[model samples]
Structures are given as C-alpha cells and as structure tokens.
Target: MTDATIKTAAMLAIGDELLSGRTKDKNIGHLAEVLTMAGIDLKQVRIVGDEEEAIVEALDALRERYDYVFTSGGIGPTHDDITADAVSKAFGVPCLHDPDAMGLLSEMYQRRDMEFTDARQRMARMPQGSRHIANPVSTAPGFVIGNVYVMAGVPQVFQAMLDTVVATLPAGTRILSRSLPCPFGEGDIGTLLGAVQKAHPETSIGSYPHFDGKRFSTELVVRGRDARALDAAAHDVAAMIEALTMEREGAKSKDLGTGELA
Candidate 1:
C-alpha cells in the first residue's frame, strides 16, 4: 500500500433498539475491520435513535467532518425504517422509489412466491442523485449519496454491501501489529505501558488480562504502520515485562515458570 494518509470514515448506527439494548449493533466492528484492511481509517462511531431529525443531524455532521460516512440500520421493510428518507432530507434531495431497485425487489419477491406489499417495496426507495451499492446476499440495495453510503442493518446483507463499496476506495498505509504476553498482570505494568504509549504516540498499545491457572497475566499488543517503530516499541514493552517479572521473582525468592515471552 502507498504511504499516503488514509481518508477517515465515520459510522452512524440508526435504530431505537440499539440504544434500548434490545438489539446489539454488529456493523460497527465489521466495518472497522474491513475498512482498516482496505486502508480507510474509521475514526468515529455513533448510535442514534430512529428519529428522522437525529438521523439527519448526524448525517450532516459526519459527512462534513470525515472523508466518508457509512450508516447502517433503519433500512429494513418496516415502518420505522426511514434512513433513506432522512439521508435524502439531510442532503436536500428527494427520496423516490427507484425503478431499477423496484425491478430487483419484484424479481426477488416473485422468486420466493411472496406477495410484494408496500412495505416490501419501501426498500426500493433511494436518495436523489445517488448510486446503488449492490447487495449480493439480499435484494434491498444500498445507496451512496455524496460522501455518505447507506446500508442495511442485517449483518449478512451489510457485510456484502460493504464488500462492494470497499473495492472502490483509495488504498492507504496498511497497519502492522505484533503482540507479546506479559506474565505479570496489567496492574503491575500499567505505569510502564503508559510511559511507552506516551513515547510512541503513533503506535497503539493494548493490554488484555487473562488467567493462567491461578495467576494473572496480560497480553500486550503493539500496532503501527511503521515497521521499525512498531518493533522498537514491542522490544521496549518486552524488556519492561521481563524486568518486572524478574523483580517480582527476586522479591518472593521463587522461580516463576517460563513459557517464553513472544
């Protein structure tokens, strides 16, 4: 990948059920991982209710602030699914049922021998002057209006639409990562980790704690685009863990079993 700085992306998850904890939003995590791999930086994520005003406000703010804005949810065949209309209003465009989308929806319904109701045809609505993002798994296609790409709420359909969109974005610097498990707990090495993070602000350091038998251990992950910088930070973190472990062993006058730090 090129060294060019990637354009940032922001996500808006629109649904009342998400905020109410009735539904867990899974699009954010999948989008983040897929966008990262495609060299697009996913910067901010927001969860908003199904209110049209809230959706419009969020769309306006995010579209202006980031290079791209992706919205998931509120696109289903239900009365509450008004994301397309809200986005159209946000861009001062008319929301109309696209003839092409309707054709696809009609074919899909006919294939299953299901009656197409107004609610099902509601999925054909697209924002004015927008391009469709095809969904391979399901019939309701996503649309890209300006910098905002609106997709479905269902996990499978959302992922398929994302695959279609990601291929068209510009490539950016790819991130690399390495991790080492510290036999000591996070509490024991939190200070040193903080210092290391301060020294290498470009790199991200994450500490995850786990139990090994009755003892607590932590896995330290170091990530960065620059290989040298990431390796240096990883070395420093490893040294810090080794020194801490040695100090603990010396104080207790006992040997801790070693599986070798990564």
Candidate 2:
C-alpha cells in the first residue's frame, strides 16, 4: 500500500525544555536512524516550545509537505501537554475521548485502585477520527491524526511509540550507504572528493573529519537508492583518496631527500 511517491517524513520535537537546553533531546537521533532503516527518508525536524499555536503551525506545514510528521514531547499528563489540542486544531477537528483509549486507561487505573482523575484521563483524549499508536513504556497511548503522529517526550515512551508507528508505515526504496575511510585531512582530498561527487550526481557524498589525538582522518560516505550507483560512487571515492595519499607520501619522501640529489 502506497500513497504519493518519494516517501519522505518530518519530525517535530515539542518542549520548552528542549528550547531552553534543560532537557537534551534523544528522540531525533533515534528517529533518524530508525526511519532510514525503515526506508522512510526523514527530511526535516523542528523543535517548538510547548505552545499550541506553534505546534499547530509546524504540524500544518510539515503534514502538507511531507508524507508523514512524527512529533515528540508535550503529550503527557501535565498542563503543558497540549499536543492533542494543538493537533486537533491543526486539522480543525474536536479533541475528544477515544473509547478504546478510555477503556485501556480505565482498566489500568482501576487495577491500581487509583481514581482516574481528569488530569490523568486527558491522556485518553485524541483528535477525532484518529487511530491510537500504542505506548509500551506507558499505558497512555500516542495517536495519529491525519499524517501527523503525536508522541511523548520521555525517551522510553517515545521509543516504544516509535516501534508501534513504524510497523504501520509502508517501506520504501531502501537507501544504501558505503563509507571510505581516509587517513588524511579532508582538505587533503576535498578536490578529488568534489570531482567524484560531480561524476555521480545521483548519490549524496559527504566528508566527515575526525581527530584521534595523534592524527586526523576523514570518512567519506556515499548514499543512494541504487546499489550500483552507490558502489560506483564508493569506488571512485576510494580511488581518489588512494591517489591523494600516494601523492602526499611521494612529496614527503622528496622533502626528506633535502638537496641530497643534485
């Protein structure tokens, strides 16, 4: 089952703590890695303070442009957890109690012999005509409204919800990636890497530089949906790095001679 091609998605991480740096985000990296493996390209990610209007605007924009929008944070039992309302307003629908969600919450609370207070019951609220996304970490469910998924900010709950969401999504053409490690600075081989990129326009080529205290190294990764294209680009990148390394080695050897040869 497929709808609209290209299979792209955007993620929204909602919280004032995120904007304030009080709570470090763990969901973005997790989502990016998971989505890539699932073959759904995660194209964009945004963080908004726990503001309803901000959530509405961001959700509207992303849901319109991408195949799906996965939002994290602001869906708990606190006053700032207004994601459900914001999502409902975004779709111009009423945020109402879901019977299935209600039953689940009610049963859980009853088992604990605790009153299902209004505040706790809010977790059962969802946008009208939406389906629930199960949360294994917490009983309160996340939900999907249109193409937007509203989830908890807590890493555990978010991860649990993500697994549930991924199962329902359609897999796309998987992106293949290969890395060529070069034991030299990126500047040493930037020119050759650029030429390799030009030669394989279909693939995405990136150079990541790293230092291991004693030396510098760069890892060049080539990514594309076509396996053959990916392999070709990787081969070109390897050859370029090899040639540059050899040239640098030759120059070093010549410098060491230091006028010994007339």
Who wins the TM-score comparison? Answer: 2
Worst 10 residues of 1 by lDDT: 253-262
After best superposition, candidate 2 residue 33: deviation in angstroms? 0.6
Q: What TM-score would every model get versus the actual structure? A: 0.89, 0.93
Pairs that collide in candidate 1 are: none
Clashing pairs in 2: none
Cα lDDT of candidate 2 equals: 0.89
lDDT tens digits, residue span 122-198, model 2: 89998999988898777999998788988899999999999989988888877789988888888788787888999
Model 2 spans with C-alpha error above 4 angstroms: 1-4, 212-216, 257-262
- Point out where model 1 deviates above 4 Å: 1-4, 209-216, 254-262
lDDT of candidate 1 over 1-262, digit per residue (tens): 2233668899999999999999998999999999878767888999999999999998899999999999999988899999999999998989999899999999999999999899999999989888999989987899999999999999899999999998898877777788897888888999999999888877899999998777788999998888998998998998898889788779666444654444
